[model samples]
Target: MKILVFCGFIFFLAIFPLSGAGFELKTVIDQVSRQVVVPAAPQRVIALAPSITEIIFALEQENRLKGVTAYSDFPKKALKLPKVGSYVYLDLERIVSLKPDLCIAIKDGNPKEAVDKLESIGIPVYAVNPKNIETVINTVVEIGGLLNASKKADALAKNMRHRIKRVEALIAKTDLRPGIFFQIGIAPIVSVGTDTFIHELIIKAGGRNLAEGPVSYPRFSREQVLALAPDIIIITSMARSVVFEQVKAEWNKWPNMPAVKTGRIFLEDSNLFDRPTPRLVDGLELLLKLIHPELINEANKCL
Candidate 1:
């Protein structure tokens, strides 16, 4: 009986560690499907999006970042990191060579096949989808928790929330709300509708999106745009040398449009406005300044 009991005890001991091995679980957003992501925290991390890279830096996990996408230019130091190619077209071989324990990617920007390939090769991938400013804050906190930087993430999230709340409070007190049209891309005449982060920013910045007919980004006819009669037109400042004067010259062709007639067209930093990151507040402040110039001083106070 003693011998049998001793064998059983040994077996129990053999399995005990396996049974109780602690594994951290983290919730994130899957950019492709635009859903919540819950994955194990990765140690050797590679970020596939510039916005994600910014969030990682904000979380102070720069040392953990092994690789970043080609376009991650902010923080200046990120430019020195290993390039994993663009999110849309990643260099799989380079990524594989990096031997990252875990990879972070935007589900929309990073192909699902690439994520699957990495997983097949025994690498973990966390997909992030921050669709709005609030979601951006939550994503930061979640990523921080996953990366063992929960305290910093919490602090960042709190600060972001406070800033957003302050904006909301100020907007609530004002009776004036401008109708805004956000141009996503110009050549094809793409505009953000209700389903995009930019759309959320428009609302947060105390403006109503005039591109309400479409649920997502859509290319509309110039006549349709003119009919919308937006009070303000916000062109994303992309490409080298944003020429508001050139844009205004084009808008002048549509003499009857409110945005054109009132000369409420403005250009905003595309990186800040389009990328869902901590700097979105800066984009909001910019919009607020354009909509209500008087509030610039107060917005600066909130910042």
Candidate 2:
């Protein structure tokens, strides 16, 4: 099955961007390992995860991307890059062959040994661990510092934070928030919980997530779903038509369900909510529209 979250549940632990720029020289700290001095502006970079790759593009540093893993298909041009491997397994040989000066890998999406191996070979590696929206925003700014593009990165981060506050304000105005259930997987139904970014998105979008347990992605029985009585049901598309159809069919079986009756069902892009990139704002905006149908026009204008 094509699960939405990466194998790590979150990105790997290390990503430290220290300030010291002049003639391509700066010391970077990793969340888990030793510090490494990177060239001020690394021209050849390898992105170990799709989220990292997305950040590189968001910073307008795509020209420096030497390699990326599979499923880094958003920008259209990324599909043409050399494939290092997937989020869990990376081809060490291919990555080494590319001779990347700097490697960016997620804490959870990448294996520690791979990152260690990259460093063993004298390749400067920066690991990132963005657990929440604030860290995600800070990480973007950190990346800018690492690449000597702090200004651009800060500008982007500022814009994102501004929009997020706007969304929060929008949610605050309405006293009635809908009970929401977001479906990520089918056949024993997997959904995000309190520990995941998706859960945070739901809250920020003004919807109360019914899956409130500590488990990042919890499984729910059909009976439990009925018990929760979600006013709205949202299904995520993982580029798979079969799973989506199944989710829709399963929910439709209960015509009396609040979500089914009210026609508040929605299908959203997995990338927008899954990846911790600038696109998260897009996800938030979309969710506001889905959860509160009345604010569709206002949400459209806010963005």
Candidate 3:
């Protein structure tokens, strides 16, 4: 199996000199609460998740990124970097071949075995777990600290906080919480629940998530969705425009549904809604516009 070969290669590397031996070392607690000994100034770093790649780029520390996992296609320039495979299925051999001084990982997406194997081979792997918008901002600051770009990180966090407060200020004007059904999966009719970033965005953007529950992502039947009578329906997709149009057409069949009657169904970029990056603030703003267009329109008139 590929996993077996990867483990064997890791074992082979473990007997050699530690990779970060000559560097200045510092002990710090990662976001996952694990104490890791990392280089005082890591020069060659590998980002284990797309979100991590975006964060590094946002902090203007992309020069230090030696590698990134696949699908880190944001910022356009990241497409030129070497890939260490997908976040869920990491290519440990390729990662080791990059000769990185550090590896930044995501606790939610990166496989635990891969982290353990990389650490076992004496590679410092600092992991971050950003569960919400606030933690995501903290993640930016923490990663900035690691990369020695603290000032940029602080400025970025301040900007995000300021934008969030502006949204809150506008939302305070109205108590209307439109019922929203956000579709992420087309075939299965999947929607996010309370624990997900999408749910938090929906709630914070002054929309009520009809799928709010214990389940992270819940599937819906056509009848069930019809029963919810959502005021707005937003679909997140990376598919072709035709596919989205087709999906929209399917939803448009129910004339009696509130969303269908008002023509409030919309399609959104999946990355903005799902990724835990600085752009999540953009997602929140987008949601607010869709959910409370009246408020935004009114605010614009005052300008």
- What TM-score do all the candidates reach, one by one? 0.81, 0.88, 0.95
Query: Candidate 1: which stretches are off by over 4 Å?
Result: 1-43, 240-243, 254-256, 297-303
Clashing pairs in 3: none
Worst 10 residues of 3 by lDDT: 12-21
lDDT string for model 3 (1-303, tens) is: 777876776776677634556889999999989999998899999999999999999999999999999999898999999999999999888898787889999999999999998898889999999999999999999999999999999999999999999999999999999999999999989999999999999988999999999999999999999999999999988885977899989998889999999999999898998899999999999999999999999999999
Model 1 clashing-pair count: 2
267 Cα displacement, candidate 2 (Å)? 1.2
After superposing candidate 2 on the true structure, give the runs of residues whose Cα lies further than 4 Å from its correct spot: 1-24, 31-34, 240-242, 298-303
Worst 10 residues of 2 by lDDT: 10-19
Best by TM-score: 3
Q: Model 2, 6-104: lDDT tens per residue?
A: 222212212312212223677868655568778778888899999988998999889999999999997888999999889799987677667677888
CA lDDT of every candidate: 0.76, 0.82, 0.93
Question: How would you encode candidate 1's per-residue C-alpha lDDT over 1-303 as one tens digit per residue?
Answer: 654654454454345421123435544444455333333655667898898899999888998888999889989999999998898988766776565666777756788898776655445677777777877887888678768899999998888888878777778878888888888677778787787777777788788888865568888787778888888898875562456667667888987888888878877778888887898887877777787766666657868
The candidates, ranked best first by lDDT, are 3, 2, 1
Clashing pairs in 2: 11-107, 11-108, 12-106, 12-107, 12-108, 13-107, 14-31, 14-127, 24-40, 25-40
The candidate scoring highest on lDDT is 3
For model 3, the superposed segments whose C-alpha errors exceed 4 Å read 1-19
Candidate 3, number of clashes: 0
